[model samples]
Structure formats: structure tokens, C-alpha cells
Target: MPIRRRLGYLPALVLIFFLCVLLYAFQLHSLISTSRSIDGIEQTADQLDNYKDEPPNKAQLKLQNSPLENEADTADKALLESPVQDWVKFVRLSDDIFLYSVILDLRDGNMDYPCVRIVAIVRRRQSITCNFAGNSSVAASFYELSENHGLSYGAFVLSCKIPQQIKPETVTSFIVQQDETKTYVNVQYTVTEKVPPSMPLTYGICIPVLYGSRYGAANLVEFMELNRIIGAGHVFIYLQHDRLSAEMIKVVNYYKAKRMLTTLEFKLPVSEQIIWYYGQLLAIQDCLYRNMGFAKYLAFQDLDELFVPYSSENIVSMLNPLFSANSSLASLRIPTRYIKASEEELAHPPLAMKLTMAAEAEDVLFTKCVVRPEMVFEQGIHHTSRVIQHHYQTVALPSSFGQLHHYKNYPSSVSNERVPKTYGKKFLARYEQVISELQVKS
Candidate 1:
């Protein structure tokens, strides 16, 4: 499809043209313009006095670099070239100023091949037209490789082809959202300095969650896994039930036994009104106190789900320092898709749901990752009839690859508890059959 040409496009083009004119104007005048511009009548007396850098505050300078990261002067091409310490600017295709994010090495300036990491978020300003689900701001991130060409700008990373899946629509709202913490990252001195400390990069699995299954082992690793299991971490389960079910009670014990469950209820009550702090929330708190370890991050998902890796880098992340600004929850929205269920899939328990994208409900799935455990509402926040209450609004998802698989939608299910029967039965049976059909190498 051709680019949607609009009146807005003109301004952007014209702005670029005008900015070029300004560049020449600044360079042409040069030092002559700098002198009088600082005076009260021209530049203002305050501007003249303030132009000078204040004496360096040694105490404030102490926490300047992190030990884990290489020294500022290490000469890492990636670190030196990335946007950081005032050398970066974000621009949109339309010439509008878009505030995304850029991180540069803040170490000694004498290094080469500085390790650079630039995560770019692209967004078109146009509003959604059709198939719009409440006009969520579609957005995507691009890893950038930029080179400063002697006052001329040279972009090496942006030119490389980005895979189709990773490209996102221009966000309607905002991203890498502004936060005090993101605004300022500490660039501590070299690791040898013992004044402050630095931490290694830690990650959280983004769970495509569902509520209770009333069955399944409590230990998350016992049933399904990807490579390995954790001793304890946040598991965001989507409890679709308005209240705790008798079957779910048994399920709750599963997590309770592993010391890993936090039951969250997001309802308003049409009939038997259960207050917060009842089942799910109670379980979460119980695990925290009993296990002697609190959940670092809880994925609100169902029992049938399991996370898979989508990127070359085992972990795909959308985390920005700005995530802290929102409430204790981060939204996890999966671009809905589906998987076909076979006859064997339907063979077991009647009404068994499937995890394919087709196994979804009328409502959209914009799950919020549980951050602060204490903040887990017992009754969950408020919701209409069949949805997770939206106490913490959603922030646009950070990636195209950051998604999980859902096994059982109610209509297609052979059994709810036996969910994701695909993995348990279908997949297993299929594997055995394939193996049997294959000729032995011997």
C-alpha cells in the first residue's frame, strides 16, 4: 500500500526543510552571534553568567560508573557509538519530536568499540481506522547503530533490515515513557571503586496467563517448562472465575504447596459479592510469608500456558527505566493468533478448551504483570463481567516476539483441568507415532 499522504505530512517536510535553513544560519554567524547574545539586552544577563560550568562536586561524581560495565574509556565500539550522556536525540518520520529512548556509555571518552545498545520505538501519529480495539497505540522497537560523522550524522544500525515481526505501528500514546529514574541513570565510576554498587541484568518472563485450572502440580516446573524452572518467581495467573471454585481450591493448594501462588480476583459482584483478600490474594500473601521469599514478578496466566523463546537473544524485553513510573503492574498484550486442534485433541475430556489464538473470548487480553506483591488486590481491581479488573491501566506492549501460548479456550476444550491437552496428550501421542513410523538408523 502507498503511504497515506495527509495534510500533516506537509508540515513535517517543511519543518525538515526549515531546520536545514536554520543549521546554515547558525554556522554562518558562528562566534559573532555568541558575544552579544549573552548580554541582558540580547542574550540576557542570566544566560551569560550561567553559561559557565559550575565547579565539579566530588561527592556527586563518586557514583559515576558501574563495576560490571566496562570502564568509560574501554574503547568498545558499541559503547562509544550509542546515544548517551547528551549526544542523543529522538526524531519521528513526520518531523515531530518523538521522545523514545537511547542509552550511551558514560565512561571515559578514550575507549574504542564502546558497547552500544539503542532501542528505538517507531510510531505513526495517525489514529486507528478499522479493526480498532479501543485505539491502543501500536508501537515497535528497532535496535539502532549510529555513527557521528564529524558533525555530519551517519546511521549504520538503522539501515540494516529489521525483521517484519519486530516492526510496530507508531504508538498512539507514548513509550519509553518519561520517568525520573529513566531520565537519570547512574554512571558509577569503574568497578574497582567501592563507594556504590551495580547489578547484573535480570529478566522476568512475560506470561500469557489464565486463571485457575483446579488441578495441575503446584510446582510451576512440575507440569510444563522451557529449558529450566525457578525456585521462586512471580507467576501471573488469569483467574477468570468471579470467585474461587471448589475445584480451584484444590488448584490453589497446588501453588500453596510449592509456596508459589497468589490468587487475584478482578470482579465487581453481581450476585455473591466476595470481598478482596479472599482466595487468590490470600494465596499470594501466604506464599510470601511461608516461602521466606517474595515473588519478584508474577505472570497472571492460566495453568495451561508455557512461555517460549522468540528472539535470537533467548530473552526479548520491553523494559525501560520508565516502567517504574506506572503502578506496580506492566501490561502484557499478545498479538492474537491460533493453532489448529486435532481429532486426538478432542478425544479426551469433553468441553476441553484449546490454547490456539482461536481459543479466546470476546474480550481483549491486555494482562498486567504483577510487580509489588503487597499491591495484589484480594478481589482484584474492578471489571465489567468477564475480564481482569483494570486497576493499573495498560502500557503498549514492547515487542512482537514477547508472547506466550494459550492452550484451552472454553468452547474447544476437551477438559478445562486437562487443558492444553495438546502438550499432555496430543503432542506426546503425535511424537510417538512419528517416531514409530521412522526407519531405524541401524
Candidate 2:
């Protein structure tokens, strides 16, 4: 009787187990189906987004069986369009070399590259055009440099080669056009005589600066004024960005309007700025090359570093003695003396008065330099290398005669964090006039 009863319950147990298995199978199938649906939705959403943002022409170009006729039409349309006109700019790098910058806003739109052939119309008499496709590698190298420097976007820095016969000073503008697309951009080149005829071998200062918050308004004014009061006849400033203070702009404009300062704009988007500072080297080189015939002496120094005289009133007076002694000197290496800020000075802040009054110590700083523009083949940040044929020759000026008064050693709010030592006494008393003049101008 017990055996028969156990056999009867076995069928019920089997039935229950089968039902559970069936339920689990159904749930698993539902979950997988839902997951597939979600994946498909996500893929569709991504495709939609890409379609909206990316140009239809770009997608068509990627297709294997894409119609060549359609592509030709698109290219023709692009050639007809002129997007580079707003972004393209030109700077005369030298008599034979021109610097052109084109902002590649590929992310923003489908902007085709300008033509390899660039034309320059000189006084509407002579038209000089060169096939620049071979130099595309140079532009690629500049993009790499910007990436190395920490920039995120692509920019083309074309060291445009001009004919030896065409005087860059006489050329008014450049025309960049894509013949296939019929698109073009006009870049205007300002050909002003920066140096006077009488002062042909003039001394100018080149300061290549990307934008930064560290350059204070009051400081910049005083800096330019001090250099002006010193021996710097012309100031060549390359500003990477236009985001400058009103006071700084005023100072720049004041000198620029008077033709004492040549201001060149560097159009590296703020979003693409890198910290490498190699652009400084390029700027220094560009400045040297551009001013080769214009300026006799080119001083490569920061706005913060001022060349002062010990006994003489100004740098012109100070350098007169050197010129008298060494007529053949191609360059002069001025030793830098770091002037540190005192704790009291930092706290009180004599910005209203002479800012240099607070400087106390005579710390050793990096060497600053002033070189003949024609002799320099290349330029480093601190010093310059001579031409391949010419040997490097520099005269080290004695400290007793005067030195560069660098305000870096001082305990300031901006850069140096080390506790500044008190060395005592100030050497910038002669700069009081310039500083005061800057204060009034500001």
C-alpha cells in the first residue's frame, strides 16, 4: 500500500518541476528581447545625432559606391564658398617669407582646404602665385607643434614663400582660392614702414606673448614705458589672444598708433592654447627675420626684464659706451640681477608709487640678450644662434656698468612661491620717471 501511494505523488512533483522550468525560460527570453530593444534604440539615437551634426556630404564621401558627380558638385560648391575670409590673416615674416594662419574649423563645418596656389597682387601690376601643396607638410608640422604645446585644435601656420623680386613692403594683400571648389579667402597684409629712414638701423624689442592672467595692467604699462624710456626705439609685440585689459590695450594702441610699436595678432584659439611655450621661439625667430632689414638691433627679453644702467641715465646712454668700445660686437649678453620683494613690501604694496621700490635682493637670474637682427639665423628663448656661415659672438656686459632688473625673485602673488629673502637697497631709481609717466598715462 505505501509503494503505490509514493508512485501516485511522483507525477505531481514532476509536473511542478516542468512548470518552474517553463516560467524561468519565459523570463529569460523576455529579458534578452528587452536588452536587444534597448541596444537598437541607443544605436538609432547615435545615428540620428551624427546625421544632424555631421555634413551629409562627408558621409556620402565615405561610401564605396558614392557618385563621383555628386562629390564634384559638392567640391565645386565648396570652392565657390568663401569661409576663410573671416579667419585668414597674413603677416609679413620677411621680404621673401610671409606667415599665413588659417583656422581649420572642421569640427564646426565641412570647410575644404584652400588652394595650393596662392596669389599676391602687388600694386595691381605684378601677380605672384606659388603652388604651396608641397609645403602642406610644413603646415602639418605646425599642427603637431601646437599639439605638443598642448593645443587641442588644428591650425595651419604657413611660412608662405614669396618671390625674391617682389618687395613684401610694397604688397598690399594676398588672395587664397580653391580653384576646384571655387571658394576663396582674402588676407590683407599691412605694409607700413615701421622704422624711419633716418633711424634705419633702429633697435626694437620683440615680446611674443600668448594670453595669460598674470600680466597685470599697471605692470604692462610701466614695462612698455620703461623700455621706451630706455633704448628700445620700436616694440614688436605678438599677442596670441586679444583678451587683454583696457589699460593694456591703451598702452599698446598708444605706441602702435605712433608707429613706435608693431603689434601682430596670433590667432590661436584660447581653447587650443598649450603650456609648452615653443611659440615664443617661433615668435622670436619671426621677429628677427621680419625686422632683418628694418631694425639694426633686436632685443629678445620679457616685458618684466628691464635693462638698466648703473651710472648712465638710460640704456641708449649706457650702450653708447659699448658701441664706442666694440664696433664689431654682434650681440650683447646682459646679466640678469633678480630683485626680490620683501615681506613688508608684498604686504604694503607700493603699486601706487614705484612698484620696483619694493625690490630688495640681488639674486642671480637668467641671462637676457640684445642681438643684431641680420646676424641671427635662429633664436632661442634666452639667446640666439648665429647664421651658418657666421660664428656666434657676444659681449658680456659687466654688472657694475648695469644689468637686467628682473622682478621675478620677489615674493609676488603670481609665480614664485619661495619665501623671498631681504637683500636690501634698490637699483631702479632712474626708472622712477618712466614708472611715474606710466602711472599718469594709465
Candidate 3:
């Protein structure tokens, strides 16, 4: 009876225990919910306080800290300013305008600064800058002038870092601006393409001779042989006509076979060939572009002219000091000392004999030259018209160094100082032997 009474009390006691545990759990849950609500209220209050102290917008910040304000300030400053053009007083357009290209060899031992040089011919004593409309401004300046010859002209090479960025097909223009005046003249521009890579030549000659059937065989032989003796690396001759003497043909064939000379035949209708001088200019320019890859220096001259160096026998040896002295030397004008043949020599007529035996200097002409392949663009018969301008002296070689040997007309006065027959004698002898053999064969 006692155990039953205890069991019945146990059920009521267990119910009471369960009810207390459930009430305690609900109180704990309520406490956590109230704490979370208080935290949310505090966060809202902190956000409201932040806005009251300082607005979170750029309008309230300093101008330096605000990009939009800085932009506005810059725009206002620009509006208040005038256009800034370069100063333009001393520079002006040249009366004779010429444009051209050159193949410049920047070879210093292993490092070569080879580039296809562009040039513009102008007239001004002060340095002028060239600005390519959308391209680079020419950093080079005029290093030469024609003031001594009673002419005021300058040849400027257009140089800058932007030329390489120019597309070959892009058609643009350049403006020539004077340094002081900042005055500029605009001209059409055609980008000169770089020549195909090749082995560098020490010296080369381009003789744009207008040859025809009536051309003298002996004169042609002497011209080629003389250049060969002077150590011409390559010789280019443009034959303007079809007919050639047997001796001339033999000489051309001999040099061509030796790979020392190249010949191009120029053929055109009489109407197209109306101007002989223009034809010559075109031929010379063509020869320049053609040989840009093959030569370090190129000389454009007549077949009758020779620049014999007094210091050294060959032209190459004379060039070393000239180049060294004027580091930026592009074109060098060596005075021409005309040596007219005697009447007795002219009567003989071959011309080669006259050159061999001629003595005494009669007239002196001071403006014939050989130019660095990369510094000249358009070549005139007597001198180069367009050259690159750099910060270096572009004076001609002094007459003391050498003078041109021009063989034409009769000697005005005879002197004991006869030209030594020994200069280029070996080549002359070979040419004579070849002509004799060809004559005998014919």
C-alpha cells in the first residue's frame, strides 16, 4: 500500500518539474531577443550621428581632394589663356623648296644607327624645327648654309622619335617652324621607307650619265677606270640611250662581270623625255634610293669629274678625317680646280691622254661634293639640295685638302707642274690593255 501511494505522487511531481524547465527556457529566449533589438537601435543612432557631424558628399571636401572640382579649375584656366604658338620671326619659307630622302649609315663598330633619312630644303640662317602635323617634330637643325655662295638656303633633315610610328601609307604634311619666331611653312610629305637590309659598303658612286650612241668610248673608259682606281665600292651608271660604242660595251661588260658596276637603261618617248635636265634629276634620285642599302657614302657626279685627294690617293682615306672632324657632316663640297687639256692634247681627242698629260690649273670652282648616303634627298647636278640638319658644322672640305680634276677645253697656260701620269696608272693600264684586246678581237 505504501509503494502504490509513492508511485501516484511521482507522476504529479514529474509534471511539476517539466513545467518549471519550460518556463526557464522561454525566459532565456526573451532575454536574447531583447538584447538583439537594443543593438539594432544603437547602430541606427550611430549612422544618424555620422550624417549630422559631416555630409558624405564630395561638395563638402577641399578642391584638391575633389577630381571634378580640379577639372573645372583646369578648364577655367585654359579658357583664360591664349593659344601658345612657337616663336616665329627668323624662319620663313624658302624660295626654292625641295624634298627628298637619304640612307644614313650610323655604324660605329658593332652598333649601327641605320635609318632612312627624310630632308627638306629651306632658306634661313637660324635653326628651324619641322613639325609633322600628326607626327614628330624634327629634332635636327641646319648644319650647313649657302651664304658664302651668295645664296641663303638650308637643308634640314626631318628627324624625331615618331617617324618609326608613322605608317608607310599615311599621307601627311610637315610644317617648318623657325626657332625664334616659331613661324612655320607647311608642305606635303611622303614617308620614305627604309631600305632592305644588306652588307654595308665603304664607298659608292652614282654616275647618272646621260649616254647615247654618240658618247665617247675613251671618255667612258677613263671615267670608270678612274673611279675603280679610287676604290669605288659600287658604281651605278644610267644609260639614257640605246647605242654604245664597241669599246664602251666592252668596258661595261668587264665591270659588270667584276660586280663592281651596275647599268640601267632609260627609255622614254620623245614627248616624255621633253626636258633633259628633269630626266637627269629623276635618274639621280632613283639611283640614290636604289643604292641606299649598299653604300655608306654615295657620290653623284659627272663622268668627266674626279676628286683626287692630296693627303691620300683614294677618296675613302680622305673621308675618315672629314667625317671625324664634323661628326654630323652629311654633304661635303670640295672646290673644283679645272685642268683644261692643251690644244695639242685636244687634237688627239681620246681625252684620256689629255688627263694623263695635262698640267697647270686654270679655273677653280668650289662647290662639288660627295654626300653621306643617309643625309641627302634630292641631288642637283652640281650639289645636293636637301640634307639633314643636325647640330654640327656642315662646311665644305677646304681647297687645301683637294680640288676636282675637270678635263675639258684647252689649257690656258702651260706650267711645269704636269699631272703625274702615275695616279690611277694601274687601272688606266688595264683599261688600255682591255681596249686593245677588244679592238684586236673586233
Candidate 4:
């Protein structure tokens, strides 16, 4: 029983201790990584705020500058023969004339109207006539279809606007043939995007809000409130009565507010009584009834968020197939919190926000933000969809409007000379109903 005998197990004990530590560290790291991912969605800077647009490097892709023509150009024919490899885009500077400008999508909103590179393409004339069944005489108008170079199959000018309910198998358009003979391009396209059972609800908007707009950077609520007044829809239509905030509202001029509203397809018929929250609810009902099969961007942003669908021209094109597969569900926005201040205004280096176990050590993660229609709902007030995201395709909408204009997002504006206490008071006025409702029982 000497001291040496007791020390015999020391080596085994040390190995066991090391193994335990390794396992513990691995588990801890995993937990910490998962925790951070749940809260943070944005990955980095340098991303366009277009959260749902497709991903393509404009450099590598072969972009169509004008419509591809099967026939040779007599005048601009010489310009059409350039063997360009980049994703080139061109516009007809002149209608009948052949002045073309080559454009590139720099992929940033700040870069207005990209630098236009002039290119040459000959414009040819093909005499063609179009015939389609129409009560109001078949009209003809010219539209440049391809941005590539020439007409793939002659200029497919639309004769007349087709009715929404009717589907015409063939559309007739008059084309000018090099031949003085009368000919027409039988433009045919199946009616895509079935009107979605009259989604009385056309507009869509969502925000991750609870009691307040604390989640966003600042002033997010103000934007939501403004969106409420402007009413959500395409540029033409404006809805009233239906509120997008789930937060209970007092008996005020407005009804209940929610993060989202869809009255486009409500079981209830559209009536003046429920004006406040009708259209938004209908949109939701329409999506559920007829638009469930509609895989395209089923949702859109409230007025402020610019949503451009895939311009690939293919009818059934997917935005980013790698991320938006038919995995248990659908489209997602890989949200990124892009700082708005210019490089000169940047007070700190651009770093993606991440949660850390130790105050110093930070780790990046993949935050899954799968946003869908069913996942979108009105829990009580503000409108929002459960977000889904991926690295390459999704974008965080950078806003000077301060995260949809929330009061909490005011810190950035604090330093601005333009902001005064009165402005803040007016914003709070928008939410007066919600404040009163949440005040107390006594």
C-alpha cells in the first residue's frame, strides 16, 4: 500500500478525463451554435436587400440583350452577330431605329440605371398579319420581345389584351415580312397564374412582432402603421377596414391590427361592415383555396418592399432551386440585416451578427427562415410570416425607414438633425389604440 501503488491508475484516469472534456465541449459548442441561429437570420453585408430574388452572377450567365431572331438582320444584322459570353442586356433606344444599349445588373439598389454600353443590331422588317377572335376588332401593337439581338421567330406583337376568364389557344399578331406578302406570327402561350380563386386578398406583408417592434433595428412599427393607412395591394388597389396587426385595438377609428391580413378569399362575402380587415383576410382565404398550388412567390412585401419575380421568361422558372426545394414546405427568404449607413458613415466594420458562448469567441451559423402562407398568420396584431432563409438567394431589406418604422428603432435617428420629439409623438399616435388596449384591467 505504498504511494506508488495508488498512482498506477493515474494514466487511465487522465485519459478518461480528456475524453469527457472533448465530448462536453462538442455538445456545448453545438448547443451554443443552435442557440445563436434561432435568433439571428442575417449572414453578412454586401447583399442586396431583395430578400426573395433569384441568385445569379451577372458575369457568368449569358444574358439575352434582345430577342433572339432565327432570321438574319438586313440592316442591324451586322450588330446581331457579336459572340458575347457575359449576361448582357440591351434595350432598343429607338423604336423603329436600331440604337441599342448594353446594360448590366450591378445588383444593388443604390446603383441607379446601370452604365449603358452601346451595341449595334440590325432591325429587320417582316410583313405579317395577325387574326384572333375579338369583339372589339383585333388591334395590333409592337413590343420588342427579346433583349438579345433579333426576333427568334419574328416580332410577336400582341393583337389585343386577352380577357382574364378566357384562354385563347393562339394569339395573332401582324409582323412585317421582308416580303410585302401578308403574314402573321401565331403567338401562343397557355394562360399561366390561374387567377387564384379571386384572392380578395392580393396584398401580402409580414413582420416578426410580439408586443412591440423590438425585433427590428428601429421604428419598424411606424412603417407597419403607415402601410396600414396606405393599405396593402398593387399600386392600383387600396384596402381599408382590415388591419394587419394582431395586437388588440380599442374601439377606435381602426379595427384590430395584425402582422398580416388576407381578405382576398374569405368565406365571408366582402361587405362594408368588415372593411377594416376584409381584403387582407380574403387574400389569405384565396391562397388557401385556389393558390395552394401556386408555387411561385405566393407572398409579397407591404408597399415598401420591392418584389420582382424571376425575369427568366420561362413560365415555370424557380427562383433558387438549390434552397427552395419541395422539402416539407416552400419559398424562404435568407434574411440579412444589412447596415444602411454608407462606407463613410460606417462606424464599425461590417461583421455578421452571431451569438457567442464566451463573450469574445463568435461563430457563424446557417439560420433557417422558411417563410410560407400557412406559417403566416394573425396571432393578435402585427403581420408577419415565419421566415425561412438560405445563404446565396435570400436578402435582408436594408431600410432607412428603420425596420419597418418601429419606435424602438429610433436610436439611429437620435443623432439625426431632422428628427424631433414631435415626429416621435406623431408616430406613437398611430399606435394609440394598441397602447390603450394593453394598458390594464383596473
lDDT of 4 by residue, 1-442 (tens): 8889889989999999999999999999999998788644443222222211122432222132234334211212211221221111222322332222221111112212111111222344322222334532333333332322233222211223343333432333323222233333322111222223332323334321122222221222333443333333211112222442333222211221121322220122223232233223222222222222222234333322222222322111323343246433433442222222432322121111110111111111211122333222211112222221222233332222112211111123222211222233443565444435554111
Q: Which residue pairs of candidate 2 clash?
A: 79-181, 79-182, 79-183, 80-181, 80-182, 80-183, 341-410
The candidate, 3 or 4, that scores higher on TM-score is 3
lDDT of candidates 1 onward, in order: 0.30, 0.47, 0.51, 0.28
Best by lDDT: 3
Q: How does each model score on TM-score?
A: 0.28, 0.49, 0.53, 0.23
lDDT of 3 at 31: 96
Q: List, residue by residue over 54-97, the lDDT tens digit for candidate 3.
A: 23432322222213322121222221121211111112243343
Candidate 4: segments with Cα more than 4 A from true spot: 1-90, 93-157, 160-196, 200-232, 236-428, 431-442
How close to the true structure is residue 309 of candidate 2, measured as C-alpha lDDT?
A: 66
Stretches of candidate 2 exceeding 4 Å from the true structure: 1-198, 269-275, 324-328, 342-365, 410-442
Q: Pick the candidate with the highest TM-score.
A: 3
Candidate 4: C-alpha RMSD after superposition:
25.6
Off by over 4 Å in 1: 1-223, 227-278, 281-293, 307-363, 366-394, 410-442
Over the stretch 240-347, how does candidate 2's per-residue lDDT look in tens digits? 435876666665655443345556665532222342353454455456655544566678777666677675755667776675576556677777765554434333
